[model samples]
Target: MKEDKRPILVFGATGRQGGAVAEALLKARWPVRAIVRDIAAPKSVALRQAGAELVEGSFADLDTFRAGMDSAHGVFSVLPANLSETEEVRIGCGIADLAAESGVAHLVYSSGASSGDTPTGIARFDAKPRIEAHIRWLPVTATIIRPMIFMDMLINPAFGLSEGRYTFFLRPDQSMQLIAVEDIGKFVAAIFADGIRFSGRTIKIASDTVTGRQLGEIFSEAAGRPVIYSRFADEVLAANSDLGQLAAILDNGPLADHVDLAAMREINPEIISFRAWLATQRHQAFDALIGSDRTSHSA
Candidate 1:
């Protein structure tokens, strides 16, 4: 089949979610144009090698965003949550506005699981619903994807993987949804391919659901050693209000993912489970973390 000539412009292409979207679009034979702050960066170079056209740009630059969106048929939008909630909302809304003005056919906004019609009292989570509202008001067709917790986050040293114990927000029997970072791209690509089917839809996505104990079991099996799992200790939570708030949100239900895994799999059949994700691209990293005695200061 002849590849689509019109490209899908992707934001944050140097980062995980956008990079995944770019790769998946490329695999599906859709032309991809990635916006990056530096085209010379290693990840940008990798994107170029993978056949993505690189556009130098930052979220703060409207001109760069317009240039990237030029002649684009679709857009995969994602922003880092490291910024203040106000800044996140600004950047996200700005992207949607640009996409609308650029006459982009479809806009897929990657949001967090906690975002919805009501406020979650978490600034980061609330920022997304605001963005979603902005996108809906725009003239352009849009899809909002609320992705569950990332499987990739499990291997982070901050999770105490290096200590043979994983401490997270969920209770021992409490199940949380998770998605492989790579699958985010697959879902985006699918949405872009059939815009009418997904347009105006707010979809929550996940590859697997597991409790804290299940996470420990999976980690132990994958690492060939017994790994323990426990909820964040009281002192630990007290020391970090942000962590405490997140834990409370998880327990209270808004932040806890309730995605339909079977339905998501039907949309993107290659969706990877938590165990599968750890055993694949993350295997080496997970192995290294398990073997190391280095402690992480961040929660």
Candidate 2:
């Protein structure tokens, strides 16, 4: 029998969630192998500098993906969210098939919070359910993590946060879960350590729960200026079908189904609160958006 030589192969290792997972795995001294379309990409180079072994590959290439996963102890799988219609399902099935064929012991798939038995009516959010179903039939032991809306997403340029105010899909007073990207890494590393604890289990991971008013307060504190939150204006959504459709789904679906904060704390005791995260991240985040520098004092 050939001795196992490959490390845990993490797909989408250059992106937010997978990158965080790879960093945590390396910090725990677990060998991490990352698949990247371009090893020369700055993010990929950063992963390499952080001690990740890189495999040049794309999601469309099953052969390279199989080689990357061969005899791996586990795999951290996260796909980019750019696919059209149900193509996201196709890519996920392809990865799961290759992992099982390569004899991977465990697979951790990162899915979205919007994925549920009932469709959310949003293509992007609803795409994961099909992929989750596909992973079920594979011979590999798989753990699915349905993560809440990323706190960092609030700052995306398209979200109007960089402008004066903010508009999101959630209604005021409706509680929704949010997780820091770093916490996803912490949570996933825990899963990788004891796949038995997580295998065959689909878990929702979150760091904090907050209402729209709470989002406003945090934004105000982080920006050192008042910021208000409201449902996207009907006219706004009507103009931008993509954003509008997502907003509609959030309004009608279980998008705001609260995650048990107590359970998440049990899994990651060090989960940061929204206020603390804002304070810690404000400077860099502001810099990215406004090209202005601000000083952050240690709390």
Candidate 3:
């Protein structure tokens, strides 16, 4: 197979979504240039070893953005959501602006699933749409992807996984969409490969849909012990404003995740279901979480 000579500059290459995109792009034979704050960091070094050309840069530095975008054919843009909303918007829009000025052929921005059409009134949810709008006005050809809740979040110990139960934003009967971190990369690579098909398009992507009850069943089966699933207790949500708003969003707002799973699978057939993903990548974690609390009664 002929190699793709044009390089794609990847931001946040040391982080989850961006790292996945870089790996997927490399697997697809696309040359990848990753911008990192620390060239000697283990993650950055691993990326370099995996064939990414690392360029030291920071989001606060416009010169680094220009240097990375220089001679690049495409860019995978992702920003850490924990940053102040102003900072997030600035860095996100700045990357898009630079990519356009540099004449990059394609730019893909990774936004959140809850962002679109209307504001969710939450800072994190609201920030992406602002970035999305900025990318649209630019002269560059761009694709925006709104990825659903990450499946990996299910295994988090904070979610009561250490107590033989799972607590999340969804009610027992409420179904929500989720995607694996690895699949995010696949979708981005596909978007970069056929920009004509995905350009100017803002699509939501997910691998599977499951209800809170279904999640319990899957967890139980995976751990070989019954695990209960429940929504965050009323007091829990009431106390933490961010958690409360997020739970409310999952209940009735945009975070409900209305992704077309079949079409997403058609685009990338290897997208793993929640059960399959748990079985493969998260089996040991699941085992450990369950094994850690042997005295906890099953729900």
Compare the candidates by TM-score and give the number of the best one.
Answer: 3
Please give the TM-score that candidate 1 achieves against the real structure.
0.92
RMSD in order of candidates:
3.9, 3.2, 3.1
Worst 10 residues of 3 by lDDT: 290-299
Query: What lDDT score belongs to each candidate, Candidate 1 first?
Result: 0.85, 0.80, 0.87
Cand. 2 Cα-lDDT: 0.80
Cα displacement (angstroms), candidate 3, residue 186, comes to 0.6
Better of 2 and 3 by lDDT: 3
- Candidate 2 lDDT over 1-299, as tens digits, reads 12343478888788888888998888877889999999898998999899999999875666778778766889888988888646788888888888888888898999988888887667877889888998998888999998888888777776566665667766787667789999999999888877788998899898888888788877666665666778777787899878876776566655657777888888888887777777785467654653343335343
* Candidate 2 colliding pairs: none
Clashing pairs in 1: none
lDDT of 3 at 237: 97
The numbered model that scores best in lDDT is: 3
Q: Give the clashing residue pairs of candidate 3, or none.
A: none
When sorted by TM-score, best at the front, the candidate numbers are: 3, 1, 2
